[model samples]
Target: MKRKEYAWAYLFISAPIVGFLLFAFIPLSYSVYVSFTEYSGYQAPVFTGTNNYAKLALHDELFWKTLFNTFYSALSIPIGMVVALGIAMSLNQKVRGIRFFRTMFFLPTISSVIALTLLWKWIFNDSYGLLNYLLELIGIQGPAWLSSETWAMPAMIIQGVWAGLGINMVLYLAALQGVPKSFHEAAEIDGASGWQRFVKITIPCISPTTLYILITSTITALQDFPRFQIMTEGGPNYSTTTIVYYLFQNAFRYMSMGYASAMAWALGLLILAITLLNFWLSKRWVHYE
Candidate 1:
């Protein structure tokens, strides 16, 4: 009867587990297999061993360029997190209409990302746009934001931060509130100034939240592509061509399935390494108490 009960327990979770294996595991396994070959969706996959990887590592110029773009975009995550945390800390203080402001901050997080990107495209329009118009008010000429190669990635980064700030800010707000008020009071009694208290106590109390935000934000930024697709299409000389964007172009557009799979694996490995590094470093900074 005990064995039969265990069998029944497994039966309850079996369907979802089977679905995950079929939909996720099988595709992932197939992609890994395809990465070792030279298959263009239509042709029989020809095993190229490590030749594809060698090409990317030793010969592909675009590989490095895409990597740089990915890095460039990720820098915005830290900048956004810092700004959002500052805003959240202030908003967390006792104040009237705080709930309304929180909702306003979180509104962007719930909106459709596709719609937001389309709207930003117009906002960064070269000829006449809200951003350029605002710059004009200050007697400063705005460059073509999404069109200029030099400005395209920066424009996307800024838009990404603006759109995503609310979620991270709310997360920090929760962390801030979780901090025990007694600690702050004790520090004040000890003659600790505001800056010193925040640095020594508030930051330590919130370090775990910071680690979580850093890892998740870095992963999201590294994989960011949809905004790039809608805004720049990885163009203006491939300046915004992140690895994921290039993978999409190669897989769906050019039908270089094998090459695209290789790129995907490379990106996955890079993300894994970065995540591991973040975890390792968090040991020193991510306080639990």
Candidate 2:
């Protein structure tokens, strides 16, 4: 009976294990091999050692530019987190119709990215855009957001923050809900002001959630692609072209599979390093019960 149970357990789990080996592990291994070779998608991969990485590091100006762009755009992560926390706090209120407000706040997260991008593209238009029109009403002239190099990345950041706000807000809302009301009551009884209680009691309890949001948001920001592909096409002097978008261009558009694979490995390593660093530093602040 014990042997039969173990066999059945393995059998039940084998499908996903096989799928992982076939789809994820195999492909990942192949990509590592490909990254060390010179190959277009159509050609046989030829061993090229570290040439792709060397070229990306020392020769490709666009690589550095896009890396910078990626980080710059990733600024939205913190900005969105802050804004989302506020929204989450607001939604956590016990007032009537709070559920409706929560749903409204979370709607954009579940909506189609393409549709949101298109809507933002229209909103960022210099001529007769809703954003510009509103600015104009205040006697201010809105710049050509998508067409201007200086403003394009900021525009992308704004849209990114808005688009991601709902999910982050939801996560924060859940975290806020998980916090014990008893702690707040204790702090209050000790003559702690609302702000003091929030600072001393609420923030520490939510630190783990904040760390979670930070790590995930950073990964998402670093891997951002679709928004730039749709909204900017990396235009206005490639100011909005992130690393992932560049990797996509090399792999699909330029047909440089090997180089793209190298980039993918590089990006993967970067993400790994950052994630490890987050975990390392989390010891200082992230609290769990």
Model 2: how far residue 258 lies from native, Å = 0.5
Which pairs of residues collide in candidate 1? none
lDDT of 2 by residue, 1-289 (tens): 9999999999999999999999999999999999999999887999999999999999999999999999999999989999999999999999999999999999988898899999999999999789999999999999999999999999999998998899899999999999999999988888999999888888899999999999999999999999999998999888889999999999999999999999999999999999999999999988898
For model 1, give the 10-residue run with minimal summed lDDT. Answer: 155-164
TM-score of each prediction = 0.97, 0.96
lDDT (CA) for every model shown?
Answer: 0.92, 0.94
Q: Please identify model 1 stretches exceeding 4 Å from their true place.
A: 1-4
Instruction: Estimate candidate 1's alpha-carbon lDDT, on a 0 to 1 scale.
Output: 0.92
In model 2, where do residues sit more than 4 Å from their true spots?
1-7
**What is candidate 1's lDDT per residue for 84-178, written digit by digit as tens?**
99999879978899999999999989999999899999999989889999999999999999889889989988998897799899999999999
